[model samples]
Target: MSELDALRERVVALERENDELRTPKRRRIRGRSVIGAVLLVLAVVLAPVAAMGTWARLQLVETESFVATFAPLASDPDVQDFVAEQVSAAIDEQVDVSAVVGEVFDGIRSLGLPPRADTALTLLEGPAADGAISLIDGVVHDVVRSEQFADIWTQSLRFTHDRATAILQNAPGTAVQLSDDGAVTIELGVVIERVKQAMSERGIGLADVIPEIDRSIPIAQADSLALVRTVYQVADIGGFWLPWLVVALVVAGVLLMRDRPRAVLWSSAAIALVFLLLSAGLGIGRGVFLRAVSPEIMSAAAATALFEQLTSLLAGTIAAIALIGVLAAMWAWLAGSSRAAAGFRGLVDSGFSAVRGAAERRGLTTGAFGRGIDRFRGPIFIAAVVVVTVLLIASRPVSFGSVIGAGVGLLVVAVLVELLRRPSEPKEMDVDPSADAATSTAQDPVSAPDAVS
Candidate 1:
């Protein structure tokens, strides 16, 4: 073979070897990219689901949480009005006041009253019934608005919390009953009994005849209760595990990326976006719930109050999570290599240096303590972040206030770290003999050394 052909073959072999070396690396890169993408997408998609599941688990599975959540609804004016209206209507339905008054007029007519008197009695009947109804309504309102009623409301919810859970789980129960049309109503037997006793004390003669009846008020309703029950069941199971799963996926996804800080930044932003979308979905679901429940079943105000009160925990949870995501993204960006991040770090460092210089000029240096802090500032900062994050997550039903407090606390810690860090003093420079002699010669040219040729 010719030398040119041999050289060509050698070059071809080197090129083939280079291609073989690049192929595995390219495949590995592509595989890592695909895995990271899948994990991130899963985390983003399931974040809202995890949040909702946590809410449902807390509100349904934990009786105490459920009671704590709904107990406050007793003080809501809208809810009070709704209860009073339902109880009064229930009483009115049981005892027809107009009919009773008509019967009395009929008895009077049998005693040969004048024709004008009969017409007057007939004209007065409706107003008398209306006046009676107004009186009942007034009593009912007073009962519902009183502190005693609030206590009863709380106690009743606590007592029936288990039953409510059972109902959500599709278990048979009589304490908290579900109507055939998907209306979940609680029997206000205690409230009704109280109302009757109050009326009797007020000398309402009809109160003596008003029989003890089970008057149920619909609190929640849907077109398809079966779907709600199914969702609750699924949420009950997922609530226990989905949140952990989502967190694992997010961590895995971030760790898999070569640029972990940037991955974390994007992941946090995506999670926050998901939370915002979840919030919007809640608003839309509220509208849909209100529309689905007919006016005959529940008033708009009452329904709105119920929905808001019940979902308040969920809303707060979402807000706290979103805040955490935003804070994480902010931290990731601040720690990044971008120009903005570098500029911010520079500005902070300059400020710290200025403060330290001022303090040193005044002879108020941190001394050994500052040096120690400076030596371990990185660990201190990391510990602070970890503590704040753990506290935020460990809080039961995390609130916006808690999240904000944590963020503020972290900021304060960072500021303290910067303030406490003192740079070491610069040492004196050592001069080289040759350079020193050259400088001396340059300063005094007449004393320069002779050149050896």
Candidate 2:
């Protein structure tokens, strides 16, 4: 009985040991799982922030490089200081990207138009080809007063295409005018013909007149103000946002077929930004407009009066139209599945049908005359209406009531043009129903295993 009791005690002791070992193993597994989950959560939370930080760093770096490279070309002390401040602010993380850009443009505004006199000339006595003595003067004069003389004199100079283009771009307020002497005009014509012949031999023409920098200077002086102007001009006239705009438009078009809501939002924003940037860049290049809200900064006062006068017209007319186009595109996107498109098509068809019914009911329909009138009358009437409207308004005495009436009339006209006018129907071949589906397939391709039995 004592031996039996000893065996039972031994078995119980072994069972207890086994339980202790199993408990620690289970605890270890639970700890490992908890650690893995924590690591996964950390990666998920930090990855996007890290990526954003990297992107911001890259942009900041690029902006810094540009600043450093173009530091010398800053003419205004205010601009230089502003640039420096922006750089410092960026480094300190005190301002956002948009704020930085605003500051830079504000600096640009500080660099206003060059001073002009009634007639200004800077003489250049330089070496001439073929051992011929040559004299050149960079001239700037008012278009009204000097137009005739400058025009004739320009022909007399027989300036090469390159030279002429250079004069046009750099010499602000320069205009070509007819010479006082008919004899001078004749001689100038002969000289120009000879130059044209020479240029033709060299495979050049008026169309080839691209303004380039004077590359004959020393390398150190290569980055001078003269060279910088060329850079700025090229950057300006090269359709500043053409490539980006096309890319955005294509992307938006592709996205339009899939996620229209997102596409409209993005595309509208991109178009608005591109237009504003291009306009502002052009204005800067041409030294046309500048802004000032502070007494210390008097840039707006010095900008071309002509530009200021035209600003209201430009902003109200052309800019407004572009903005409207963007809004329309966005609104169409908001109505997905081409429902907006169908609505527009129906609207156009309804208008034309109404017009046709009206003509039929009048019993005034003739074959050729009616068809011709139907085709041409709209445009002709529109043109006549526009002219008469303008003349009538202009002829009327100016008053607050007249101006208000004109504004109301104009608004009504615009609304009618947009909503009531019948647009030509688009051919069915223009849109491919399968393209959007194909694009989706391309983006997320079908697997061979999925297709297999």
Candidate 3:
């Protein structure tokens, strides 16, 4: 056993020696460079992702956009109904109508003047309960429709948008607030307090419960409270620097590569993959988020609509990033050895040449104008692509349709420009009469020297 252990140790030592002898001194440095290059590529790829996340958070938290996002909800029956239900539930928790009705029935039993009193109380129970429900619902409806309610809704939605998950994190204060650890909650308090006042005026006894209730409902939360903190941490940390750091790493990697174009192609492909993951991850997250908050608590449709709207910017940014990466990789590949890219380039060049030849035949290529057109044809086509891309980006929503439309539109513009750019050139064709006559005479037997002799 001792001999075997010694043999194993000697073998390990020999392998170590062999590795050092086989490896160049610079090999370690090369490995480090490769690792650094990879890290840089990741940084570059992640820059856009971080940018997307930051933009999403800003849209969700910013006042104007947040208001605009939910303003339409005021008119949406489904959304209004959802809000009414939440407020109604809150009121229910504060005012126990069932207990109130039970007490009235017990009082009739204590009176015991007649069996009719007990029976009368029994009949009143249903209508009384219905009347109470309708009154509270009316109060809620009035609150939901009022200008005051809209103001409250906007503030509450904005607050919830920013900090709904945080209180679940035990961050302090009510579930909804303007800032972390702030005591002031942007709850349905205004709406609820108003409803309580109205209900009190109607001689209902639930005004006291309204002030005592301080728990504001959250629009979003996670399974574990810790996860809610994790979200805030990630959003805060990744907000500005994560993407920039990624961009720096990618730039470093590309700069370090022996062949930059290939590096760009690979890096772009990697970026596309990352954005693809981001896009898919967003989808998966939507499901996870939906699972955490139930339809029983909030309307599933409204929740879905809200989630979709909030993440729309992120989705668009991801798609745009993916598209740009794909286009860059395609260009790099074309600049290298892709058959399709070569064919595309060939087709464009051939079109330009054909157009120039046709113009020349028509005497339109007789001057510097035509020469200039030929010289600038490539730039003109590229310029058209740039213009079209700008237009696509300027569009309100850059959908797949817009991308396809831009591609087709740019292709058409390039073809038309190549064909029609030099139409104003003169059509004069110059012919050499002396060469024509010499060629004709040489072909004639009578004009040939041997034939003449």
The numbered model that scores best in TM-score is 1
> Tens-digit lDDT track for model 3 on 260-327?
66777978887777888889998999997677655655667777776787677668767876776787
Q: Supply every candidate's count of residue pairs whose N, Cα or C atoms clash at under 3 angstroms.
A: 0, 7, 8
Candidate 3 — what's its lDDT? 0.66
Q: State the lDDT of candidate 2 residue by residue for 132-157, as single tens digits.
A: 11100111112112334334333333
Q: lDDT by residue for model 1 over 223-329, one digit each (tens)?
A: 77677677667877888778778877887897678777788899899989889888999899999988976476678898898889999999999998898889989
Name the regions of candidate 1 deviating beyond 4 angstroms. Answer: 1-38, 103-126, 166-184, 221-237, 425-453
* Top-scoring candidate (lDDT): 1
lDDT of each: 0.80, 0.37, 0.66
What TM-score should be assigned to candidate 2?
0.26
Query: Any runs in candidate 3 off by more than 4 Å, and if so which?
Result: 1-40, 43-45, 56-61, 68-79, 96-122, 138-151, 158-186, 193-215, 220-261, 295-303, 359-453
Candidate 1 C-alpha error for residue 34, in Å:
5.6
Itemize residue pairs with steric clashes in candidate 1: none
What stretches of model 2 exceed 4 Å from their correct place?
1-148, 152-161, 164-222, 225-252, 259-266, 277-324, 327-453
- Model 1 lDDT at residue 367: 88
Which ranking of candidates, highest lDDT first? 1, 3, 2
